[model samples]
Target: MLVFWNARLVFLSVPKTGTTAIEGAFAPHADMVISHPPELKHAPLYRYNRFFRPMFERACKVEDMETLAVMREPISWLASWYRYRQRNFMQGHPNSTHNVSFDEFVNAYMRGDKPAFANVGSQAKFLEPRPNGTRINHLFRYEDQSRLLNFLQDRIKQKVSLERRNASPRTQLDLSPETLKKYQRKFSAEFDLYNSIS
Candidate 1:
């Protein structure tokens, strides 16, 4: 996450949404950057509200920071996770996708108790609004990099260039039509949320 205190903006890093690249591009200009420790780097809306929000509001006396986050298309996002876990080093890890097919991984994800390989968190859940009404002020689609870049440049008044970073390994990923339909139906929020965003 990158916080631009002067601009009253915080960029929430959603996993697999090109946030690493975004963080790298803006870290130099950010007032505070939480780039270490994956948990903090990808703190969801609830975590932010629970921890960081209080810090800003009570300690810093800043309560009006706007939050920004990116959401990738659901299937593509899952594909990234599948490929990421397939890395050689992940071979014997509980979350490894070493010998799993995309369909099997996704199917496991739909279960009440997901296997580690298919337990990647949901994008919609990550950005869900809190009971107190805290929510993302600006949400961009991962596929729409130009819009995000323009918004950042306009807000920060600087040139920003992002390099491709932490890309998952290549894989031939295709889910069966039935499985795709099931996934869309079961986790409609992810699709609905992405579609709602311009």
Candidate 2:
């Protein structure tokens, strides 16, 4: 997560949504950057409200900072996770996807008891609105980099450049129609959230 205190903006890093690239690009300009401890790095809305929000509200006396996030197409997001875990360094890890087909991986993901390899967190849950109505002020589609960059440049008043970082391995991934249907049904919240992003 990158906090632009002067801009009164907080960019929440949703995993696998090209947030790493954005963080790298904006790190120099950000007032505070949380890049360690994956849990805090990808602190979701509830976490933000529980932790960061109170800190700012009490200490900084800041109550209206806007938040930003990005969501990728659901299937592609899952595919990225599958490929990401297949990297060489993760070969023997319990969460490695080295031996699983994309189909099997996704099937496991839908299980109530997901295997470590398929336990990636949901994008929808990551950005869910808080009960207090704290929500993202600017939500961008990961595929729509132009708009995201445009918004950042306008807000920060500086030209921004991005270089791809932490890309998942290349692979041809296709979900069978039946599996896709099941996934959509089971994870309707994810699809609904992405669709609502515009």
Candidate 3:
């Protein structure tokens, strides 16, 4: 999607899902790169984070770059994200916010209330045509990563291979009948979109 748009690819890093590894791999290939702002510098970073801000606006105007992101299934993604944060961010706090289990997290995600799950960009928005009727040229599935990379190579005329750097921590979950219905309802559009494209 980024290469296709000829705009600087923004990972829009959601928790876990190997964002760091992906950024590391793509940095050399990118003309410009941005990563998570350091803890102390986060406030300052946000002041300058807008793509339309002066520092980036001129560059954006001159360079035809593409912004791209990846997404995963919400239930699986949220479960892994929760575990990743519990290990990395919630270390030794007096009160911990990481007690939720996979099933609990999935319930919240299905309701679109979890921050990690909410952070992934909207596929419907990404796929919708612009006012000028231009649609994003590509949107790839993490499940179909090899094909996505192959398609990118074909577009750029360059050979690139990506290694799988991370996998979901919760490998198994028992979904109740009610929970299954919630997931289907919550992600109906995405499921439809995937089927149409596939």
For model 3 the local lDDT of residue 98 reads 58
lDDT of 2 at 173: 83
Clashing pairs in 1: none
Pairs that collide in candidate 3 are 6-64, 6-65, 6-66, 7-65, 7-66, 8-65, 8-66
Indicate the TM-score of model 1.
0.98
TM-scores for the candidates: 0.98, 0.98, 0.62
Per-residue lDDT, model 3, residue 153, is 60
Q: Per-residue lDDT of 129-158 in model 3, one digit per residue for the tens?
A: 445333333556656667756765665556
Clashes, model 2: 0
Better of 2 and 3 by TM-score: 2
Kindly give the stretch of ten consecutive residues in candidate 3 with the minimal lDDT sum. Answer: 39-48
Model 1 segments more than 4 A misplaced? none
Residue-level lDDT of model 2, residues 35-96, one tens digit each, is 98999999999899999999999999998899999999999999999999989999899999
Model 2 TM-score, all chains together: 0.98
Best by lDDT: 1
Deviation in Å, model 3, residue 168 alpha carbon: 5.2
lDDT of 1 by residue, 102-148 (tens): 99999999998998789999999999999999999999999999999
